[model samples]
Target chain A: MAATTKGDAGRSDMPEAMGAGIRIVAWNVLSLAIALVIWQLASRAVGSPFFPAPMQIVDAFIQLATRGDTTGHSLWEHSWASIERVLVGFGLGVIFAVPLGLLMGLYPKLYAGTRAVIEPFRFIPPIAWIPLAIIFFSGLTRFAFLIFLGAFFPIFTSTLVGVARVEPIHRKVGIVHGASKLWILRHVVIPTVMPDIMAGMRVGLGTAWLTIVAAELAGGISTGLGRMMINYAELIMVPHVIVGMLLIGLIGFLMNEVLLLIERRLFRWRWQVSL
Target chain B: MHAPISLAKVDVDASHRYGPLTVHDGLKFSVAANEFICICGPSGCGKTTLLDMLAGILVPSSGHVHIDGTPANPKKHSISFVFQEPSTFPWLTVSENVATGLNIKGAPSDQVRSKVASIIDIVGLKGFEDYYPHQISGGMKQRVAIARAFATEADLILMDEPFVSLDQPTREHMQREVLDIWRHMKRTVIFVTHNLEEAVYLADRVLILSAKPARIVAELPIPLQHPRDPLSTEFTEIRSKCVQWLHASH
Candidate 1:
């Protein structure tokens, strides 16, 4: 829609979202083209068996997407497996972390009681827990546990900070309005911190995705992107390994975009600093 | 014999200290039902701190606030505090902001709608009800604040220099708006401001306080007519007297 309001900075023929979309797609294509050219030139000059040209990696990826290739499963299957682990781990992390974090933010005493346990545990790397996770849970649950460990603390800490950042005066307004503790949490506290919570979910999901790939290699999982890369590397299939790495990066970008879309839909009132 | 109406009170040597220095001490006062009172003092003399104490946001180290002989409590009596700073919630539109108190109180949807609309009109914000805080100017946000305060019809409204941030013209305009709402609603209001003229213009009684360790220095009563002419002899006489007390305390 062409804006009728004054002082709107006037519009071009193109809608703002469309204009921004064109610019982003143009930049992405140009950058990817340049990178592919550089990789091809570098590989042709070096002439090493270790490094494959961009075309070879794309062919390997196409092979995975079309047929089972060496892994006996399509690329879709590996991607889906990785995504399932991330979803389960991220979902479990959010279900417990958000409420617990909010409670801790509201009540310092609750935070104090749990601080000692969480503080030391958060410092340990998620991959370090692979041994314990495998011992505790078998198969898929073990991989999920590693992803959960990666996702939990970031979401928890972000929620805690966001809740604590709510303006004191806003709470006073709720208090004076006779809003109950529960009512205030729902209406006043939650809305104020929602943007942060959504952002944390995006971050936590990304972390879980990254952790899941690493966990798959160590957790004896045979059907994920990480496991596929390991299997190919053992066979000295360099192009296949590069294909797995690139797919992980592409999928990660797509997941973040999905979360950003949701964040924008939910928090319309929030204004981001733009160019 | 029982009093006809119960009002709120603040007494019992209420004071605050920052380490060694005291901000207020022996600050005792009481307000009558439906009265418009102003606590006037020098700048940074803890006028806002006094309102916070009454609103239960800040608990006085020693004294207590009472409503109808019971300690002043938000759960017991409806109390609203309007801060001097523009306190409109940015995420909520004007109508939503005004409707919040009523919605929290569990009013019917129709009642909330009507009350919000009526109060928005009363505060001269009918058209801007859909506007967010960022979409409007500072003074309009003040109107939203007023509408929110009046809509609640709280037993007591504590205002800590609510219009002090506006420009001179808008400040005067808002002062009259506040007086109109206070008169029509007949709700007890304890306004805190550093300006003597504003105190004389709006308050039925002005509680003048000392500079530091602010305590009630004097209580000046104003029987002046409504829509008071600032240039009139009566208004200036009262304003000057309040000013003298404020200066002397400083």
Candidate 2:
């Protein structure tokens, strides 16, 4: 019976699983539709100015896309402002912290030198840095500082962990092959640590998004998702405020999707094994 | 004709205030150029730890390791190791992993490419040059490990139970592959394993060890030629002799 079942499994599983792509798309559409229907019903029942209907938010979205009335910036411009802060801040954090983390992981002295400073600071939320960041840095630099603080520790800590986690046997392979310490770091340690680094980047970027919203709301930004949401809410444009919040959610989701795509491409070897 | 590597009076102790625990003590051995030697013992008999002391990855509490009759220094001596679990750089393709040692040794570009290609082909990984380690089977990974060992043309090659993790069929195939590579390259090899059959199958000389404090108990030489059949009487006789020595040690 087991032998017959094994023979039948090959014929049964192949064609049905062939179009996984189409099945995924179909499932996603169904899930989204179910969500929208529930949200539409809930909004209509609330019937409050604070809670606008789904259709009202959609209409407000169309209006914002076509015209930038109150702030004199396009909806795209506001979204772009938030995205720019995320990129510059996250980029600065990555460039500065990755190498430092790698170095600290390799050399004990470096880690010992900076451990006291980093351990305390890593615990503080990025939102807490907004007031001090405004004083220390002017305008866009202030927002950048906030985002960088949010992103830096995650990326740095992961890099350190990743480097430390490299198997001893792998390093032994390099040593036995007569590779120098520097050569082993470049060829073996760095490559082995990359997947962990990428995972850290994804997490750090999420924190950057969260911090940017808080920063824009509190730091008195002229144009951004958080600023737009606050400004429209004050003006009693409830639908527009909802539109701003949803836009932020959508844009953050898209950015994460792109990062995941890049990671999947970079680490294709990691997932391709049938064994 | 000269020995490329030798270890004398090596000792590793892990005793506490309460009692005594000596892992290895006074191990003395030598490997002649181009000789394939196997270190066989019961499990946890410090075979791999022995390899580590020889490779300078681990320092024995007291010992002398010599390479080319000089004090052993990794930077001065070229030695290759094939770990029990192959350590191919996950990010590197099969050819790149094969080329790594050669590049570090500063081989010319043309030489690196040809040598890497030839070694990959020799290991029956011709079509897998572009494949990553994760995409291949465990047996294929060990083949790459052996290929890397041979490609560097090191003075000594230390293998720590490289095929013990593999299935019987794959183990037999890899043993043959190792023999084939040894014949072609003619580098000194010290392979460590717990399996007596595996030791008899591959080694020119099997150095059997006692249970703990792990001293070398006996040297059993196999005069059978390459590609020796495991089913043959001569093979079984030698295997039995090695097993008897191990049982006696216990």
Candidate 3:
């Protein structure tokens, strides 16, 4: 009986699973369509300019994409401005944080010595630093400083955790093999901590995105998604503001997806234990 | 055939303490070059601490461990290890893991490549050179660890219950494979385990250690040769002697 059932499983399972998959996708589309219809109806019934319909936002999206915004910067330019700031700030944060984290992890004394200064600043939110950041830095530096403040702690903390979590046995392997201290750092310590560092980077990227948006909105930056949203908000162009918000969401999601892809590629050796 | 590397002769007269708590007191032993020495004891015995001192990872609170007339230092001595836990670097492929020591020693690329290839083949991992540790089974990962230790052609090889994690069949198989590798390579090995049967099966001489503040309670030499049957009278005699020593210490 078991053999017969097993033999039939291959022939019977494929289309049944495929049918379920198709049903799921169809349900997703239907649910989204219903939500959009409700949104459209609510906007019409309210007759408020603030509550723009989905189609109105879509029309605004096309308009912003084809023609320049009020400031003559295309939607792509605004997005590029936001992305460029994020990349610079995030890149700098990773470069500084990972090595410092690794060093601090290896030398507890270093962490101990600096903990007093680092801990308090880490707790202070990056948004709180906007006024000081604007005063201290100008242009890209201001944006980078704010974003760096947001991104730095997560990457650094996780890398520290990664170092702490490094298996003593693995380090013992290096020691027994007579590997030099630098070689152990490069080969054993770095590789062991990579997955943790990658996880930290993912979190840091999200924080960086949020920090850049807030900085752009408040720092009086001339060209960014947040800046464009503010411009529309002042003019009572709610649809364009919605377009900016959605664009921010879409871009943030895509950046996260890219980092996730890289994480998967980097840690292919990680064991996947299933119950 | 290439010349076999000179094996290390170890001499230990060490006592270790942890914050006023003694782990091993006056634990003295010596391993001859090319000898297979297994140390077994009850749980909480300082078998691993002994290995750590020999590997130069920890210094004894009193006395010293010497390898070939000098103080034991991993940097000064040629040593390799197979740990109780899975210690293969997950980022490296099988070939690279095997090649770790040689690469660290700054051996020429060709030498490393050949040594890694031959050792991988010896361990029956030839087809899996590109595979990572996580891609392999538990037994296979241990095999990789074993191959890596041998590939270094180190003078002293320390294994702390390298096969304790495997089930019965795989453990038995690995025991035999390890014996063959030791016979072929002829390095001084200090293997630590808690299993009496495993020690009896593998060691030239089994060192039964007493419980904490651990010291060698008994030495049971297996007069039986390689591929000795566990059912054989001498094999059982040696195993029971080790068990007796363990029970007496407790």
RMSD of 2: 5.4
- Model 3, A1-275: lDDT tens per residue? 11112223223455665888799999999998999999999999999988999989999999999997998999999999999999999999999999999999999899999999999999999999999998888888889888888999999999998998878878778888888889889888898888888889888999999999889989467899999999999999999999999888989889888877787677756643111
With candidate 2 superimposed using the best TM-score fit, by how many Å does residue B25's alpha carbon deviate from the native? 3.2
TM-score for chain A, candidates 1 onward in order: 0.92, 0.89, 0.87
- Candidate 3 has which clashing residue pairs, if any? none
The list of candidate 3 runs beyond 4 A from truth reads A1-34, A271-275, B243-250
lDDT of 1 at A13: 34
lDDT of 2 by residue, B1-250 (tens): 1232432222223211113667776766676667788898888877777787667666566656666666555566777888887688778778888888898899999998988888888888887787777667778888888888878777778899898779998888888888888787777788998888888889889988887777778988899997888899999999999999999877
What class would a CAPRI assessor give candidate 1's docking? acceptable
Instruction: Give, for candidate 3 chain B, the lowest lDDT window spanning 10 residues.
Output: B1-10
**C-alpha lDDT of residue B171 in model 2:** 88
**lDDT per residue as tens, model 3, B1-250:** 2455676999999999999889999998899998898998889888788888999988999999999988889889988889988988888888888888888888999999999998888888877787777667888989999998988888899999899899999999889888988888888999998888888899999888898999988988888888989999888887887888989987
The DockQ figures for the candidates are: 0.37, 0.42, 0.46
Chain B TM, per prediction: 0.93, 0.89, 0.97
**Best-matching candidate per lDDT:** 3
Kindly list the per-residue Cα lDDT of model 2 for residues A87-164, writing each as its tens digit.
999999899779988989888688989899888999999999988887788777988899999999999999998998
How far residue B248's Cα lies from its native spot in candidate 3, in Å, is 4.3
Candidate 2: which pairs clash? none
